[model samples]
Every structure is written in C-alpha cells, then in structure tokens.
Target: MSGLIGKKIGMTSIYSAEGTVAKQIPCTLIQAGPCVVTQVKTTKNDGYEAIQVGFDDKKEKNTPKPLQGHFNKANTTPKRKLVEFQFNKDVELGQEITVGDVFEEGDFVDVVGTSKGKGFQGVVKRHGFHGVGGATHGQHNRQRHPGSIGAASYPARVFKGLKMAGRTGNKRVKIQNLRIVKIYPEQNLILVSGSVPGAKNSYVIIEK
Candidate 1:
C-alpha cells in the first residue's frame, strides 16, 4: 500500500450532513505531503519493491554529509523525515507526491505516530486501576494506588509484563481505519475522522 508522511495540525469539529441529519463530527487535521521521492528500490537490487519518500525540509548545515549526497542524488533539498512505502504505481526520483494525488474523501487510512509523553504516571491513569481503599473510614492514602501486584509467598518478585505505575505514552501507535472526512489540495491539508496519535506538528505516517 502507498503512504505519505504528514504532520498533525491539531483537531477540530466539523458538521457533516448525513442524509437529513446534520451530525457534528470530531476530526483531526493533518498537513500531508508534497513529499519528494528520494529513492526507489527494486526486487533485483534491494530484494524488495518500495519507494523511499522524504517529507518536510531540513537545514542543509544540520544534514550529514552522506545524507546531503543522498538528497543531492534525488535533486531535492534535505528532508526531516524519510519513509519507505510499497507503491503500486510507477514512481521516479524527485517526483513530488501531494495529498490530492494520493487520497480522496471517504477513504479509510491508517495513521502511525509517536504518542504524547506523560512521564511517570500512576496506576489510575496508566492502567486504570480502581482505588485500593474506600473513600470512607479514614482510608484516604491508598486511593490511587495499585492494590496488590501478585502473591507474596509463591511469587517472590514481581512478574514480567505486570501492569504497574511507571512511564506512560511516548510510544509508536497506529490508529487504523480512520475515514477521510475532507481534503484541501491547495492547502495540503486532510481531515480524518477521530483523534490521531502524537502532539501538534508531530510527524505521522498516513497509509492507505
């Protein structure tokens, strides 16, 4: 499937006409593409068929010497993000792929991005654990604590993959089957139904 590198431009609510009813749809806006094709791989050479595209501009001085040569070979400026996608159509080096050329309204796409970091979180927020102690009877300290992890005698230590209070978010997450509500070619913006992972302006991979 073909994909594009895009940035999350926050979210907003839009009204959609469903037959006679006007429904308020919550969607996330994304600025997709105008991506440049940096490299093309073939089965005979790279043992796979894919195209490497780059999105967003990067300062020339900040780019490494090797990457500078790579961009030079494509005859395009350095990019901040480069991703490979299995493309079915014929693609050439330095070809510009915009949002209009890739997707249209009512199309279902998958968005992959890094989730927002929540730092150190408790079980109530992280694992959705109920309070260990009740609100009454002066039991106020263990409200948000993660009751008991495991057996004390049999299992001496905490087992692996146990849900506990720790670091949260800031992980690669993929939201699948998101319908494209609208597309603005001139502005290079696309609105997808529902929320997407990551913070504002963070890079996301939108795949069809």
Candidate 2:
C-alpha cells in the first residue's frame, strides 16, 4: 500500500450532494501535493522495495547542503519534507506524484500523525480508573487518588507497569479505515470524513 505525506490544513463542515442539511463532520483538510520522487529503492539494491517522496518547496537558503545534493540527484528543487513509503515496485526518480495520482473520493485510507500533547494527568483522566467513593462521607481530596498500592507482605513493592500519572499525548497515532469524503485535485487538497490525529497544521501520512 502506497501513501502520501501532507500537512493538515484544519477542518470544516460541508453539505452532502443531495442538498441535505449540513453535516458537522470532523474532517481533515490536507494539502496533498506536488511531490517528487527523490529515490527509488529495489529489493536487490537496498534489501527492500520503496520510494522516497519529497514534498513542499523550500528556498535554497533554507535547505541544507546535504539535502540539496540529494534533491539535485533527483533533478528537483529542495523540499521541506521527505518521507519514504514501501511500495510493490520502484517508482521513477523525479516523477511527480500528486493527490490525483494516489487517491480518489470514497477510497479507504489510514491517517498517521502525532496526537496533540496533554500534560501530566492523574489515573482517573489517564487510565479511566474509578477514583475513591465520595467527598461527603469522610473522603476529601483523596477522591482522585489511587486507593491502594499493593498487597502487604508478599510482593511488598509496588508492581511495575502500574498505571500512574505521567506525560500524555504528543505521540504517533493512526486512525484507520477513514472514508475519503472529497478530493480537490486542482487545489491539491483532500477532505477526509473524520478526525485525524495531530493539532492543526501538523504533518500527516495518508496510507491506502
């Protein structure tokens, strides 16, 4: 399955074609690009089959020398983002792969992205643990605390992997089998039917 690298352009609600009422869907607006094939890897040469695709134009002053050389080999200008995806066969170097080339409306795809960051949180919000009973009946601020640590004598130490408060979110996540609502090839944009992981303007990878 091949995929495209794109930037999330926020979300919006749009009406269906049947003139139905506006549906408030969690749509992801992505700029699905004029990407250039930077490198082609073959099974014999690289022990795998894949194509390295580059997206978004960058000025020469903003691009590093090493990457400039890389894009030079592809006979394309410097790109801001580059991602490699494994494909069944090698793609031609410098070939432009646009949104129209990869996907169409109603296609099923999985969107991969980094979820928004949430700071340190308690077990109730983090692990969904039922906190202590009540505030009126003797229990006070302890309502949010984890009740017990462990058994008394045997295995006295608190067990490892016990759910605890810590940093949350800001991790790579994938939402699978999302239906494609629309594709705007002229704008190089794709509208997905549901929410995708990550904050607005974050980069996402859409895979078929």
Candidate 3:
C-alpha cells in the first residue's frame, strides 16, 4: 500500500451536512501531500521495491550538502521529512503524489508518528500499576512503588524486561484503521477521526 507524508495541523470539530445534533464529529486535521518523489528503489539494485517521498518545504541552509544534492536530483526543493513507502505498483522518481491520488472520504487509513516525549516516569503512570495495595492500608512511600522486584534469597536480581520506569513516550507509534472523516484537496488537508500520535506540526505517515 502507498502512503503520504503529512504534518499534523492540530484538531477541530467537523459538522455533519444533515444538520443533526448527534452528528458532530471530532477530528484531527492533517496537512497531507503534494509530496515529491525523491528516490525509487528496485529489487535488482536495492533488493527491494519502494519509493522515497519527501514532504514539507525545508530551507537549503538547514539541509545537509548530501541531502541537498539528493533533492537537486529530484528537481525539487529540500523537504523537512522524507519517508520510504513500498507500493504494489511502480512509481518513477520526481513524480508528484497528492492526497487525492490515494485517499478519499470514508476510507480507513493508518497513521504513524512519533508520540510526545515524557521523561523519567514512575510505575503508576508508565505501567498502570495500582499503587502498591490501595490509597489507604498504610501505604506511605510504598503507595506508588513497584513492589517485589525480585526473589529474596534466590536470583537476587531483577529480571530482564521488567516494567520498571525509565522513559515514557517519544517512540514510533502507529494507529491503525482510523476513519477518514473528510478530505480538502484544494487546501491539501485531510481530516481523520480521533487523536493521532505526536504534537501539532509533527510529521505523520498516512497509509492505506
């Protein structure tokens, strides 16, 4: 399936044409496509079939020399986000792919993005730990603590892949099968129902 690189433009409510009171829908607005193809990979040469698409305008001063050269080859300006997506059909380099080419209203699509970063967290917030026993039971400092980490006189060490708190969020996340509420081709916008990963203006991939 093919996908488009887009920027999340926050969210807003979408009203129904029927003027029904219960038909108001909340959706996240995304600025999608009009992406330019930068590279095309083949099975014989690259051992795969995929097209690299670039989105969002980036200044040459901010882009590295090598990447600038890459954009030069595409005959387009620098892009802020570049992502490779494999398609069933073949696509040529420097081809322009827009949102209308792949998606339409009421289509189900998956959105992939980087979730917001949350530094150093506890088990309660990270792992959904129910805080030791309860709010009472004389919990004190052990209320939000992760209890019984290891066997006492046995292994004497915490097991690997334990749900201990360290870092939270700031990871690649994909939300699947989100319904496409609307598409504004003239404005290069797509409205998806429900919240997507990452903050406003963050890059996201919308895939079929």
**Over the stretch 67-124, how does candidate 2's per-residue lDDT look in tens digits?**
8899999999998888988776546899998899889899999999999988998888
As for candidate 2, its clashing pairs are none
Model 2: residues with Cα > 4 Å off, grouped in runs: 17-24, 88-90
**What tens-digit string does per-residue lDDT give for candidate 3 at 1-208?**
3789999999899777665555777899999989999998888999988889999898899999999999999999999888999787767778899899889899999999999999999999999998787667776678888888888777888889999989999999999999998899998999999889999999999999
- The CA lDDT at 75 in model 2 is 99
Off by over 4 Å in 1: 135-138
Candidate 1 per-residue C-alpha lDDT over 1-208 given as tens digits, one digit per residue, 9 for 90 to 100: 3889999999999998899999999999999998999999999999999999999999999999999999999999999999999898898999999999899899999999999999999999998888687877876788998887878787688889988989999999999999999999999999999999999999999999
Of the candidates numbered 1 and 2, which has the greater lDDT value? 1
Clashing pairs in 1: none
Most lDDT-accurate candidate: 1
TM-score of each: 0.96, 0.89, 0.91
Error of 3 at 75 (Å): 0.6
Name the 10 consecutive residues with the lowest summed lDDT in model 1. 131-140
Pick by TM-score: which candidate is best? 1
- Residue 180 error, candidate 2, Å: 0.5
Q: What C-alpha lDDT, on a 0 to 100 scale, does residue 115 get in candidate 1?
A: 99
